[model samples]
Target: MRTRIITAIVALAIFVPFVIKGGIPLTILISLLGVIAVGELLFMKKRLLVSFEALVSFVAVVVTILPNSFWRLLPAPAFLNPRTLIYLFIFLLLLTTVLSNNKLSFDDAGALSLGVLYIGFGFHFFLQARAENWMAFVFGLIIVWLTDSFAYIIGRKLGKHKLIPKISPNKTWEGSIGGTAVATIVAIIFAESTHFATHFSLFEIVLATLVLSIAGQFGDLIESALKRYFGVKDSGTLLPGHGGILDRFDSMLIVMPIIVLIGLTA
Candidate 1:
């Protein structure tokens, strides 16, 4: 518990200032995170066969970091959106179906493409959120962090029923409910008190908080599921007691994008 608290504090110390500064620094920060995530995915897969896939991943990251001009020279936006993902998968299928001499299978290509979308596009939202509204983006982040922290503490003390024992044994229904409730309350208080979110109504803030809290837990569960699927404990051991960068920011993975969408519509 002490270790997790300390880690959280240290992470906030770095993340707050970094996210607050909305510029190339933030882009680099997220790009570096994307790189770390890619490394972890490769580590998990154990074989990044098909050199073109590696090139495409690099291009995706570059398109994410650099402006549209770099990617516009080629057609790369197809990989970022969901509707076009099927086409990209089909292209990969053809590539692996013919290019490989049984060195790569359809399953391998599908998983690799999925990883790229998951990590690559996920990190892009960090850039997107920062660019949209740093204040609301920061607010959304606090909502998730508070939700996860309070949920875990409350759940540990009062959790009764298992939420999803298969994906995350530590999770509980009570904890999930507690976390969302606390997060909603915090969002209301923050919205009422803070002048930064004056543009949003209190009701909207509450709704966003509820969505973010539930999605944040799913984000954590998603990471836990991935780890369980691979039979690995943590994504990486970069943090002391927090496991890895992914473990720390798993909830952020879900929250940031939602925040971006909200900011866009709001």
Candidate 2:
């Protein structure tokens, strides 16, 4: 517990400044995070499968940063939504091919692809969010962090009934509610402070906050399920006292894309 608190403080000390600055520094931080996430996925899988999976994940990350027109390089009759088509193509391509007869077989490849899309493809959402409005992009991050922190602290203190015993035993309904409430409050504060007052009503802030917070919790649950199914604890030991890159940012990965989409539409 002490280690976790200390690590959180140390990470914030390093991260807060760049977040406030929000430019190339933040972009570099995002790129480094992408690299670390790729490393974590490779680390989680079998050694033999690591290379290929990492390569594919890397390509996904690259595609995320690249322009949408670049995807037109692929053979035609593409869907108006190139992103969806691209993901579907990747999924089908992997499902059809036989990688190896090993334990981490075709099924594992599918799982890894899911991770890639979750982490890699989702990052494009972050990029899009930032491109639209840097403030909105940062707000999404703040909302996810607030939600996770509230959930952890509240669950640890007052939790009785398990939310998902098979995945994350510590989570509870009380914690989930507390997290959502706190996130909603923070979102409202952010909207007002950032001059979203003219553009969005209190109801809109509340709605966006609700969506992001729920999505963020679902993201955490998803990662927990993945770990439970795989019989592993912590995605990797890359970060001392924090498990790994994925362990720390699982919810953020999922929420960022959704928030980005909302920002784009809004």
Candidate 3:
């Protein structure tokens, strides 16, 4: 518990400044984080880390996380967009299987490809959220933290039934419900106090916060499921008590994309 709190402080000290700055620095930090996240997934697959497939996966992740404005840096042949480049990198991963004499395997390629997309888009939208609006982006962060904290507190005191004992034994349906309900109310209050005040109706605010609160819980569960499948206690041991970059940011990876989408439609 002491280690966890200390690590949180240290990480926030480093992370919050860049988050507040919100430019090249933030982009670089996020990109590095995305790469590390991909590395975590690759490490799970073992041998693939040393293979050519890893390179392709890393490049694809970097490209996927680049903002639309950054594409201007790509010289000439304007039709070769980010999506095209990403697909090309994925194609390289697929081709690596044949080139490696099938040692790499199609299954390996599929896994790397999926990891690139999931981690890539996850971080990409995270950057997108920061770029779009601080208040809006922070909405995702606030809800996730609130939900997780409340769920833990509520679950410990009153939880009985398992939410998904197979994946995350500690979580409970009661806690999940309590967390989301509390998070939604707090998030709505937050939105009311922020930019969401002018643009959203009370109904709209309720609907959006409710969806985001629920989505945040699912995000944590999804990461828990990944770790369960990999037979690992945590995604990695980079953060000591926190486990890994993925462990700390798992909810954000899932919530950021949803928040960005929510912004788009709203």
Candidate 4:
């Protein structure tokens, strides 16, 4: 717990500054995070296969996150868009699998491709959300953090029914409910206390909060599933108590994309 608190403090120290200075600094910070996350995903596989997948994932993330202006500055053709790059990398992974004579199975190829797209696109949306509205981004982060914290605390104290014992044994239905309730209250308070209510209707704010909170929980479960599949406890040991970049930001990964989508339509 002490380690977790310390890590959170240190993370906020670095994160808050970049968030406030949201420009090249934020871009660079997020890009580095994306790279590290991709590296951790690739590290799930054997060492021999890690290099190829890591390189491909890194390229995919860079393509996804780079601004249109950056692409324009390059003399590359119009076909060099993010979608094309992702598909091309997937194709290459498939080819590598074939050439390896079954050393890399179809499952491995598919997993690698999915990892690249998932991690890359997740950060892509995160960058978009931050670019769209820093306040909204901060709000989303608060919701995710509070949900996770409340769930842990409440679950450990009063939880009985297992939410998903197969995926995450520690999580409980009571915890999930408590977390969502607390997060929703926070959202309401945040809306009333800040300018969020003025920009968004009360209904829209409530709906977005509910969706983000639930999505955040599911996101954590999804990461837990991935770790389980990889036969690992944590994604990486980069963060003392939190685990890795993915472990730390799994909720944000899902929340950011949903928030961006909601922001677009709302």
Candidate 5:
């Protein structure tokens, strides 16, 4: 518990400044995080499958998160476009499967592809969300943190019924409800106190927050499922009590994409 609190403080001290700056520095930070997350995922996979998966994930991160302007500046061929890169990677994976004498199964190929899309693509949207509006990004982070914290506290105090004992045994229905409620309240307070109130209608804000809060919980469950499948206790031990970059930012990965989509439509 003490290690967790100290790690949280040190992490915030480093992360908050980059989030506030919101430019190349933030991009670099997020890109590094994406790469580290991909590395962690590769480590979780079977040893024989790690090499190509790492390569694909690294390339995906580079293509997905780098600004379009950066791509434009490069004197690369048209085939180097992001979509083309993805297609080429898929083709290579299929070809490798055919040639490797059954060493790499379709399941391995699928896992690699899923890892690249899920982690790399998700972090791409995270960068886009922060670039769209730093305040909204901050608000989304607040919602996730508040929801998780309140849920844990409420669950410890009053939880009775299990939410999903298979995927996340510690979570309870009472905690889930308490977390969502706290997230909604925080959203309302944020909206009322900030300039966001002037831009978005009350209905829009409420709807968005409700979706984000639920999505955050689903994200947590998904990560828990991944850990169970991998037969690991935590994603990694890089952050002491925080597990890994993925563990620390799992909810953000899901929330940021939804937030970006909401911003686009609004």
Candidate 6:
């Protein structure tokens, strides 16, 4: 617990500044995070961090994470569209299977490909949210954090039925519902307190908040499912007592994408 608290404090110290200064610096920060998140999935899959998949997937993620403006600023030769680069890298991943005489296997390449999309788009949407609306960004983070926090607190006290004991044994329906309920309320309060104006109507914002809160829980469960399948405890060891980048940002990974998909960006 102590380690977890300290890690959160330190992480925020770095995170808040980049968030406030959203530009190339923030882009660089998120790109680095996307790289690490991809690395964690590679490690979980029993792939070497220095392997071909790692190199290819890292590049794929960075390509996906780079905003449209940044991509335009690159040198002429580096002007390949993001999709073009992604497709090229993906082909390379499959090529590795044949090159290695099937040692890497088709399934391995597929997994890495999926990881690229999962981590890549997740961070890309995060960057988009920050770039699009500051309030929208904060709202998404609050949904994930408050939902997790309240779920733990209320679940311990009032939990009865397990939400999904097989994947995350600690989660309960009581906690899940209670968490979403509280998060929704808090999000509305935040919206009101900050006079969080957006193109969307207040009704739309409230509805979106509810959706994001629910999505955040699903995101948590998705990561838990991944860990269960990998037979590992944490995603990585980067954060003390907090697991890894994925562990810390798993909920956000899901929320960020939904924030854009559902037009939560103010």
lDDT accuracy of residue 67 in candidate 4: 53
- The TM-score of predicted model 2 comes to 0.80
List, residue by residue over 108-130, the lDDT tens digit for candidate 3. 88988888888889898998888
Task: State in Å the error of residue 188, model 6.
Answer: 1.1
> How do all the candidates rank in terms of lDDT, highest first?
6, 3, 4, 5, 1, 2
Please write out the lDDT profile of model 5 over residues 1-266, one tens digit for every residue: 99999999999899989988877898888888888887787777754324764676677766777756566888989878878887777667667678876576677777767777787667887877777776787778888999999999999999999999999999999999999999999877887787653667888788888889999999899899999999998888889988998898889889988887777223
RMSD of each: 4.0, 4.2, 1.5, 2.0, 2.0, 1.6
Greater-lDDT candidate between 2 and 3: 3
Highest lDDT, which number? 6
Q: Which whole-number lDDT from 0 to 100 does residue 264 have in model 1?
A: 31
Can you give the lDDT of residue 206 in candidate 6? 83
TM-scores of the models, in the order given: 0.82, 0.80, 0.95, 0.92, 0.92, 0.95
TM-score of 1: 0.82
Candidate 4 overall lDDT versus native:
0.82
Candidate 5, overall lDDT?
0.81
What TM-score, to 2 decimals, does candidate 6 have? Answer: 0.95
* lDDT to native, each model: 0.72, 0.72, 0.85, 0.82, 0.81, 0.90
RMSD (CA, angstroms), candidate 4: 2.0
Kindly report which residue stretches of model 3 are placed more than 4 angstroms away from their true locations once superposed. Answer: 264-266
Q: Per-residue lDDT of 15-45 in model 6, one digit per residue for the tens? A: 9999899989999999999999999999999
Residue 209 in candidate 2 has what lDDT?
83
